[model samples]
Target: MSLSSTPPNTSTPIEDPSVYLDDPNRKSLEIDTDTHQGPALFRWLTLGMEYLIGAILVALIVSVSSNVVGRALFNHSLPWADELARMLFIWLVFIGAAAAFSRYEHIAVDALVRRLPLRLAHMLYLLQHLIITGLMMVMIWGGYQVLERSSGRSAIMNVPLSFISLSLVLCVIFIAAVSIWRMWVSLNVIRHPEGER
Candidate 1:
């Protein structure tokens, strides 16, 4: 048996400042108002709100399920439980979707994008932002119209339909904000030589 000894290579990692710089194309554009200098406070606020809503949804589901199970096993049903659960489920879907946008966790098809060159990928990202912004604007306008038209209608709980419709407005507003933020970032990457992402 022969023993061989070799020194392992140890080298310091190189840091690239360009990764920290903003894109040149977007430098002339207005800075994003969404991102403030207050210690990322808004992020935490939004996150808290999102989690609270999620918890409410989960609790509603659990309560509804328990009620249903109790009624089935005991031969007595809570008539309102199903309706209440449905409403909460609706709210959960819309609010959760909106929250996804805020956190940049929404599903996106980027398989082709991943194969593209860095510059092209950036351009595609900018295009995606523009498309999303337009879509959100449409949703906001349409939701407002629907709310106005359904002003007199009421849900099972006698709640105004507009209350439910307002969820669309809230979702659109958040989505638009996220889209604008994305656009701002894309523009910055295009502007400053050192800001390329």
Candidate 2:
């Protein structure tokens, strides 16, 4: 006796991820990390950022939870908990953003671009990445200035304020590098749409 609630449809073939590259008309996001295109070092950096973001998130949770429990049960607060949590939260946001950008996971409105010719679409993509790179450069400069001027420590934890600004600078630097690389890829596709892979 078969234990199936309903028979599966075995006639349909599984779609291969590589097929997207072969079809110019396919307008899909590349969500598979196995097929990620980049130098090994860059890929490693993105993976590291993802791991760091997770660790920071866990630390942030623990800090807040311990403080809450202490206040409720012991009628005493962990003074350093709030400051540590805030610092971890800042790191999480910046690192998470960099990881998301590396994977092209950020929200974007590309309906019009999807409908355009492949070369024309890539032209727009190149322009978009150029603007992003420029903005990131400005952010890096501003972050560096802030880091230099931030001489004070956190109120309770005594952690240096420059540590917080360092996160912003590092995040923008990675994002800017990614933007430049993406711009180069877009430029290549514009020059040779048939050679895209």
Candidate 3:
């Protein structure tokens, strides 16, 4: 066969985005990363949360495992272990939630969003985040109020129940900030649907 002008294995340039999108292995095009420089404190705080969550998880595993082994082998349980595991479990849950929110991976039903117009979808998305922010703010306030009465100390650890209440406050703070960030990003997308992306 006669040689064509184009070289071998040279795929045709994509004129329509749909053609490129059909490729399962195609790398995603960069969108908001170019102009989106979030706050320095937010970045550092998320990073610290990553490390803290990891440590808490590890401690939780160790405490539970050791408690199990101690009871099985020595017939004597570590009295502090049950309490330590409980506290660490709470911390782990809250920290893990914060990390998930920061990454925007929390659960949501999005079947309806896919069918909406692009502008309306962005608007609704931002509204969803605003609602979450408002709800979490109420949770944080309520948690603080109730924490005043949960002042009794843990029987084994002697740590006040208020400390556990603080975990709820911390979790909601991260979630609220992340929800706000998501809303801000959605607003930007709505305003500049063509350029910002």
Best by TM-score: 2
- Give residue 88's error in model 1 in angstroms: 0.9
* Backbone clashes (count) for model 2: 0
79: Cα error in model 2, Å: 0.4
Best by lDDT: 2
**1-197 in candidate 1: lDDT tens per residue?**
96659666788899886543433333322223265422253366466658878797777978698787988898787766776676677677778877666654566555676566555666777898899899999999999899889866444467777877887788788778867876776666656535454
> What lDDT, from 0 to 1, does candidate 2 have?
0.80
Residues 1-197 of candidate 2 have per-residue lDDT tens digits of 86989888778778996643333432322323577657666788988888888888889989999999999999999999998988888888899998898877787766677667888888887888899999999999999899999999988778899998899999999989878877777777788888764
Ranked by TM-score, top first: 2, 3, 1
* C-alpha lDDT score of every prediction, in listed order: 0.67, 0.80, 0.74
Give one digit per residue, the lDDT tens place, for model 3 in 1-197.
98788778858776986542332111111112234346656666767888999889888889999999999999999999999999988888888887766644566555676556666777887888799899999998998897878969999989998998788899898888867876777777788776542
What range of 10 consecutive residues in model 3 has the weakest lDDT sum? Answer: 23-32
Deviation from native of the Cα of residue 24 in model 1, angstroms = 18
Q: Sorted on lDDT, highest at the top, how do the candidates line up?
A: 2, 3, 1
